[model samples]
Target chain A: MSVIILAVFAAVMILLLVGLTRALKSPSTGFARSFAVVAMVLLPSVWLLAMLVYADSEMKKVSFCTSCHEMKPYGESLHVDDDESLSASHYQNNRVDKTKACYVCHTEPGLLGYMDAKLRGLHDVRVHYFGKAPEELELVAPYDNAVCLKCHGEAKSFLEGGGHQYPDTLIDALKAGEMSCLDCHDLAHHLED
Target chain B: MVSPFQLFPTGPEATTRVLKRGVVAQILGILVLAGALFTKMPLLMVVIIPVGALLIALGILAWVWAVVWADAG
Candidate 1:
């Protein structure tokens, strides 16, 4: 079954290549242009299905998030966040597990969200290649604390005095500065240590 | 001589080429998933492999489809 699928896939690739050479001028209207038609319809669907499956199985693992060495600071900070270290309060206290609990905020929804992330990654890659990113690690800019608020919302008991305690009357404090969740807490998940 | 269809007297065009690649890629992606089920490899890596393949296919398809769709327009 697998072999047949692979062969059919290869055949389709060959057909598309041949089709491209033939239909350079007009593609859609052509009856032989079924390749374009099928591709157009199937790509997103496949991607969505794959993501759903992958996410269901492994995407939610905290270990996956802090795999990168750069994420160590983020990871360590999550453990260190407690009343003893209110000064270092980053991700809402012991309530949220730092290791496997970032996607709850960082991840957005839909195609544009995915594309935007990919583009950002491409930029990060380019920066790393060209030595433009930071010598050390840094926060994902525009890391609006708003995402933190998405879940925390100053509603959780543990967050009564949590670092991310959405400041009331900060109507000015928020606009006055570039404060974000990472400003205090270190990177949590996807650790490299 | 008459052909079954009046296919512009040549092989597929760029648009069709990309389309074919994408469909094949998606098909191969499915196969990868199946193979993963039968293999001992890490499910994470196995799953990820197909994602890359799928993206390549979709990216190419989008590129080509825009060309053909535009030309047709």
Candidate 2:
């Protein structure tokens, strides 16, 4: 499927090149002129649209996020069999989409969440390549409980789970920003001391 | 008996200029995409996607300018 999509793009590229060659002509008339217009403008526009769609789809993949050298360890942690690792347990238990586990925990709720993440990913790229990276990896901001609550806040199992204590009070604290889910669930990448 | 270049022979100087600009824009767009995806520098996509759209716009303008002006003489 991927190969076929690529082949289509390649064909389009070839057509675009042909269009460009035709466009170089000084004086075209009638049908030739019309073909030049379509080739030069319409075809390239379609190709660009397809490129954006392709990029968006690729961004959603776990492989895309973890391909970064700095992110490799964090990606590996997801596969750890230890029950103590929060992210690993989630992966092992199928609590999150394996393909989009990063997004599951990271994306805030709402339309802006995806856009925000994409922007953040851009920032990551800049920092990774052009900026002075930190000696140790850290979240750019403090972790937000809201990201967790987006999924588990209303889930029956989470609310009624034995592990939670006075769930309402904890949730209130979470909302008030007086508490952090990470305080108890601090195994994000499980970096060693 | 048709030569490739003659198939769509080079346009007037104005047409050539517009087409050349379009070609450059398209090349820049491709570079943006390569920098973004291949180097794991997705920040470049912020530039790439816009450049792609820009290429489309330029291509249209080039075509229109050619039709209205280049061929007028």
Candidate 3:
């Protein structure tokens, strides 16, 4: 898919060059004029917009995020078979879509959450390039409980689950930032001990 | 009345300069786009996308500007 996108971009570049050349050489009419006016100017703008949309969607895939060298461990953690491993359990048990696992779990709620995630992704890219890639990467902040509750909050299994049986205290603790689900459960990435 | 679309300016030298600038912009736009896509660097992408588009836009503008002032020759 990435290859296809690259090829399409390359083709557009070629077309732009060809059209520009034709306009420069020929008289201001006929094939040269029409191709220059339509193909050179308009087609590229449309093609670029399409490319941006395609790239954005492709970048959401788990494969895309894990492509970064520093992220491979986290990606590997998802495949861990141990039930205690939060991300592994979610992935192995089919709780999350494997293809979009990164985005599914990481993208926050509300209107700008996805955009915010994308911006953070860009920051990661910048860090990877400009800054020293961390020997051990950790989340800048702790994970939000709301992310977990976003799904499990309403589920009967979660509501009746052992630790969650006390809805008021547990839910309040989880929400008020007094407790983290990870305090008991294993961390999601399982990158380190 | 002058047609909106024209190609070669009466001063061929100036027309050549525009073409040269257009070509350079096109190359830069391609470089930015290809780098963003091949590397799949998200931060690089966020920066390059708008810049690449601007380069392409400039390339087109250079071509159009050249044509608008161009002679029928």
Ranking 1 against 3 by TM-score, winner: 3
Q: Sorted by TM-score, highest first, which candidate order results?
A: 2, 3, 1
Q: In TM-score terms, which candidate is top?
A: 2
Residues A52-155, candidate 1: write the lDDT tens digits. 45543443345544554444466565555354432224355544444445544455445665556545544544554454546566557666655555455546
True contacts kept of 3: 0.22
Model 1: per-residue Cα lDDT at residue A133: 43
Give the winner by lDDT.
3
In model 2, pairs of residues that clash are A24-B10, A24-B11, A25-B9, A25-B10, A25-B11, A26-B10, A26-B11, A26-B12
Candidate 3 CAPRI classification by DockQ: acceptable
Model 2, runs deviating above 4 Å: A21-37, A162-167, A172-178, B1-20, B27-57, B64-73
List iRMS (one decimal) for every candidate.
Answer: 7.4, 3.3, 3.0
Worst 10 residues of 1 chain B by lDDT: B34-43
Q: Give the Å error, residue B29, model 3.
A: 2.2
**How does chain A of every candidate compare to the true chain A by TM-score?**
0.43, 0.78, 0.73
Interface RMSD of 1: 7.4
